[model samples]
Target: MTTGNDTARTTVVVVTWRGREHVTACLDAVAGQTRAHRILVVDNASDDGTAALLAAHPSRPAVTRLGTNLGYAGGLAAALPDVGTEFVAWLNDDAVPAPDWLALLEDALDKDQGAAAASARMETAGGEPISLGVTLTADGHGADTTDTGTETTGVFGFCGGAALLRTEALRRVGGVPAEFFCYYEDTDTSWRLRLGGWTVLPVPDARVVHRHGASSRPGSREFHRWNERNRLYMLIRCAPAGVAARECARFAALTAVLPLRRLAGRNLPPAWNFRTGLRVQVLTEVLTRLIPLTRQRRAITARAVVPRPVVWSSANPPR
Candidate 1:
């Protein structure tokens, strides 16, 4: 979806790494967007010759090749300042969006003056439903909500994998958290935008087909470690004042308990690899930055106009 700018109001950014098989189709689909938009590809040092492939394409999108992989969020963040558009749309190289995907999200954001972002309905390429939108629990556990034919603007956050972001709003909060590097960065950004008094919404009619974990191999030790650790950072860095104490206690307790529980079969998930050292690392990561996170909390506390409860509520308002 486009926001009606004379010279491409939105810059569609696709981040890729050794994604030669998938990037071609993804680029073609992006070129077919119903609305006019610019395209950019940030290559995270793909040895697969993804750059050569892009160079030969008719679209000839501007490409930035990095020396080493910067994970998903880092690659995109690196390209943000030069985006030069009112909005930015992210497409996972593993996902291909429907032609109207950008248009629908653009329309939703245009109509909602306070909304900072809008996400497309995503499903797997095999037609399995992924997420219609999102909502979060009191403890910062995010859940994907399937489309129920009654979808609305409310959502916990846009999955960074595919979504439209308001450029100015994104820059105001210092862009995505690079410390997260990859996983949970979007969740942390969502909390920051909400706390900055902007709503993150969903365009349920806008659709995309995502090949889940195509770039980052699922269940990889690196993936799981970052997954658990970043989730902790997300809650600690942005959980509201009311939810902070409980969320922190739960996070700290789990950081300690996940390792210990692996000692007993009845309490452990079979796949648990017993990374006791990684668990300790996650526990201390936040405590090391207590001063900075507290400063962030204060800024969010003072700027937050929307009550945390209202921003988090899942109850559908009467339509």
Candidate 2:
């Protein structure tokens, strides 16, 4: 049941690591898309025969192989130069899209000219809905919504795993920040889109099922390290100077209070791991502030189409 309009509009880019099985499942789901999309599987040096699996799908979407692991940002960036469509949809190798996902995203962007990117409802493997977008609280925390069937405003950011970005908007933002090898790349890019006067929308009609934590080992060192470091990096790179300072204060307070909260629950090992990771993140930020912060400041100040007040207020409110 291939739809007639599938060939011309969208290009789907899937980035994969060492998840050959998951990548195969993801590609099968993409092959089931109703609205026809050009597919590109960017293999990030998977040792698990990922390239061979992609090669087997020659009759479907095209495949691009990177000789080395470039991480999420690098893999997607490598695919950008070859994308020749109106919309580019990013799908993680460990996620499977619903049959109508492409159609739904296309419909949302078609109706809103200002939409720079649109995301579908992301669900867990067991069908529990994941919060793909949310409104930001004053302290940089997000309020998740359960109304998974309605269009919403004020979607602060989206997961790169399952989102459709306007080609022109992506071009304007100058593509994903390759400096961010993995985590928070989506947040950084989304903020840049908003600052450039483009809107990011979340379309509930579209959906994808993600196998959470499949790519990384649970409670592993790399998992904790990258998550903490990238979280801080994203906050620093995206927020205005005053807002960034406020967020840093809020985050520090939260970290200091975590041990007290954990006293009632989880064991000491995870707690100690978290505290150590936080310390490492803080030290890394202090050591590298001169270079990354200077670059971030230049980027934000140069193309600031939106007012600082709007950006700041959007992030913070009277509590």
Candidate 3:
């Protein structure tokens, strides 16, 4: 079922950490892509035989093995420098895309010269739509957009799970903020793309079924720690001044008040016993890194092609 159009200009980069179970199937799906995408697997120091499996796979995707367990963002950061493709598409090791997934995404970007990235419509194994793109929450956290009705629409961000990014656009934004490690990295980059006057679009026809949390289980302490901390980092680096300041103030206030409320035996938010501690740690970490964060914020501001107000206003456009 190959598309006659040439697709050698695109590279599929899959980042995996201890993903022995799904790497084979993931690669198989990539191999079946209607367009012949060059495949690459970035192994994040997985000692679980995942590296060996990839090496032996018949399709023989080029492998880059990092010595340390740099998270997904780090994995991409490592591989992206070596990627000479016009486009780079990331497919999670645990996700399997439709046969025509790459073809459709490539088509979308080909048609829209202004779009820096195109997000895929992702679903669960049972065919439940899970993510279309990213929508900024009222609290400034990144959440997935689940609108299935749109064929293609402007979005604030792309999900790292399944998205095709223009190589030059990505390099211009500094190639996937490796500082983020994993969580919210894509959203942060999306913000950068928008600020640089590049559009992010959702292409619902390009589909991927992801086994969410296959690498890091949601709600786990590790997940919350990185997720919470990274959200603040992303806001500080990419959000408008008013939005960043307000969210940071609220976070600090919550950190201070939540402990007192618990001591008073007031009913705390469910699952917040640990969250209070997480907030404190996140606040401290952000403060410790404030100098670097401020530098990044200034850098983003200096290179921005679109005004902050305009980017923030379109964060969650009317469906």
Candidate 4:
């Protein structure tokens, strides 16, 4: 890939929370990237020998072990201020990118000055495409693009697990919201970038093999709660009226029916009932937090060059 400017320095950040079996290989792949990048490992106070493993890894990335778990968004927030590089690439501990991933992403970004970030195609180790780019739903859920993924696909934004973000764009948007702490951070950033008049590009040729449950296991009660909690929060804080209204109705409908459904379904597990209650609690959380993030939302939306509908549709993608 051609280095468009003198500031070609790329810093790769990998955040892990008790990712013992995953961090080593993640670092190895980062070190093997076609571009010589400065790798940084942010450990969320992992006691699972992740800290020790990073110390022993051959890559020798700059490691920061926080005193407590600040979640993925917070970890990046803590590290971004100190990042002097032109671009910051994020790779979760459980995800490993192909050698040319960084090169391909940079090339795509260099060709389009409006692009705030570039994303890699995420896939399972077995070659199943996990997600191409985000396709946001009115229900406050983001669909992972899984079909006809071309080499130069454009998207609303890149997933947090495998993305290269421009440093200046992050700074302009106040960085990723640490308040989100975990889920929805990526989607929030995507919308902010779009609203801030920047494009988000997706590069299909750049592939990453991701282990889905290394940090937050899917289908667990905690996973469902955070996902539900964050999804509502995102809709409230940043989503446009149409999206938010749709999600509100969806939540309302579910809340109204779950009690009756639970009564009729005798075979439903205890965990099922518990997660259902958690979803309602998610609504309360969203309402409570919405007031505080409203100012930020207004500020973001006020700068919109890319409208909500265009972003949702990924219209006029970069050539």
TM-score of each: 0.87, 0.85, 0.94, 0.88
lDDT of 4 by residue, 1-319 (tens): 2112235478888889998988888888887888767777888999988888988887677788899999998998878876788888878889989999999988888988888898788999899988777767645586567665534456666788999999989888768788777877888888778777887887888999999878886777766677777777666666777777687778767777777777888455566324467767767777777678677667767666666666655532344
Best by TM-score: 3
Root-mean-square deviation of candidate 2: 4.0
Cα deviation of 99, candidate 1, in Å: 1.3
Which 10-residue span in candidate 1 carries the lowest summed lDDT? 310-319
Q: lDDT (0-100) at residue 72 of candidate 1?
A: 86
For lDDT, the strongest prediction is 3
User: By how many angstroms RMSD does model 1 differ from the true structure?
Assistant: 3.6
TM-score of 3: 0.94
Stretches off by above 4 angstroms in model 4 are 1-8, 149-153, 264-274, 307-319
Q: Evaluate model 1: give its TM-score.
A: 0.87
Q: Candidate 1 on 216-310: residue-level lDDT in tens?
A: 87777777667766776666567655566676677667767775576664465443224666666666776786777777666666667666556
lDDT of each: 0.77, 0.73, 0.85, 0.77
Residue-level lDDT tens digits of model 2 in 122-186: 88878788755645556454344445443644476666779999987898776877766776677
Error of 2 at 318 (Å): 3.1
> Candidate 4 local accuracy as lDDT?
0.77
Q: How many clashes (backbone N, Cα, C below 3 Å) per candidate?
A: 2, 2, 0, 0
Better of 2 and 4 by lDDT: 4
Q: Candidate order by lDDT, highest to lowest?
A: 3, 4, 1, 2
